[model samples]
Target: MRKILTLILMGVAVFSAGYFFDKYEKNTCRAGVAYSIGNVDQKFNVSEEQLIEVASKSESMWEKAVGRDMFHYDPKAKLAVNLIFDDRQQSAINETKSREKIAALEQSYEGSFKKHESLTDQYKEQAKLYDELLSAYNESLNSYNSLVNYWNNNGGAPDDIYNDLEQKKASLSGQFDNLEIKRNDLNSLAARVNDLGKQLANITSTHNSNVDHYNVQFSAPKRFDQGDFSQNTINIYQFSDINDLTLVMAHEMGHAFGLEHITSSASVMNALMEGQDRSNLAITADDLNAVKIKCGYK
Candidate 1:
């Protein structure tokens, strides 16, 4: 009986150890505390505390999904938007600000410059063709004139021969007229190039000014990761040009937690927000499933 009881106890101990190890291996991203990277821009509407608050809200989504804490607030964190406001812009734009005006102006100037560049090669080819046609027309005119003089000087020349020269002159004159009209069209296109150049310069100046304004309006967190898990930090930048500040914050936190952008518009991890279905600012079912697959549940 003693021998049988000893074996049973040993088997239970071994089973318990195996279960602990398996659970430990599966649990991920629970090691270190994350710190908030403080605000740099004083004028930013969202305070550092508020940034933390939003991040906490984002964390709740992931935590609920994984049944584990993915992030925590530490005073120290790394820093890591706006639209004419470039998509690259990180600071959030005020909702009251005119996104339409900025977007339209940016579109007009950027589109104009791109169109101008495309036309350069086309215009060069057209101008070269015009020159070639002009040369051919001049040659034909000179040749016709010489033939007419010859007929005038030599009145005995056949009437049929004179008729042929006149016909040739008329044909060349018609071609020259058509070529001149095409050349005038090209000239009009050339004038637009100069006008677009000025507009491009003006747009460039305006874009720089808007960028500078955003720089002053918001601040981003600093990022620091040096191989050590404890040292890994994601300082969330509080200011953004997008109205969905919480969504952006969640996206950044996702990066810190080794999550990637998803193609589904339903996910907060989408690469683009434009035309995306951002009905929920939290991690979707798919997103949670992916995280669980990667990080496992508690």
Candidate 2:
């Protein structure tokens, strides 16, 4: 299978190199210089200075991986994100304010619980007083009503209206007391729950949707022997791929470019990965176009 695929890429490269010899005049990409062969919305050459910037970052990343107590692994299903680690950007945006707001709400609820406890205690204390006052008021109100009825039945008494009004006042006083008790009970539970906190938020809001590329070392050098719109995209296999190095880098770069894995074998953006899918290490037209679109190409 490998030999057959190699023959195909070499033949195509020979034909394309012979045809558009002008574009191949100067090669800027070096060993492991990552490139994408997709429908990239934006395409530009990285300056020599920028290339240096990219390459200088590898040393520190490799160091961290070596320093690990143990390589962290997911036991159930192992899938690690690829990246030669980059410098940690600490000056990124912070979300502590939002977390603080959430914590404030939690504190409010905790206070409510405390208030409920206090209210319960108060309610108990006032219950005895309320019962005594309410019972007395009711008994007085009943007596006053009886007197008014007797007065009305017998004849109009001098203090009939005044005494009746006093009985109604006493009844209202008891109602007021009951209302205060109920209000305290409801107020204690009026506050609500909120967010506890966001203590370990490493990624900030600006980078929320940023494309994360993993450290992808190709199984072999990648190359695209043919020329097309996709071929405009470049991948460096140090100019060597026992197989199609461009295709492999382009395909994997499609993943780094943040395109989802898909089913098209003819695509650079195929969901299939090495040791994971059925295909030679190469990018297809679909993979190129998908990335071009994501890169904001028209």
Each candidate's clash count: 17, 24
Q: What TM-scores do the predictions have?
A: 0.44, 0.23
Error of 2 at 68 (Å): 20
Candidate 1 lDDT over residue span 1-298, tens digit each: 9999999999999999999866644543555236564433444555556666766777786777777777777665442211012222322345225444557668988898898897766788889999898898888889888888887898745978968887897899799789989889899878877787788899888877776665565233212110011124443333333235566666666766666667776676666554333355567887787677666553
- Candidate 2 lDDT by residue in tens digits, 97-198: 334444565556566556556755665666566667667767866776787688779877677676767667777677767767755654543331111111
lDDT of prediction 2: 0.40
Instruction: Tell me the TM-score of model 2.
Output: 0.23
Which one is best on TM-score?
1
**Best-fitting candidate, scored by lDDT:** 1
List per-candidate RMSD values in Å: 14.0, 17.8
TM-score: model 1 vs. ground truth: 0.44
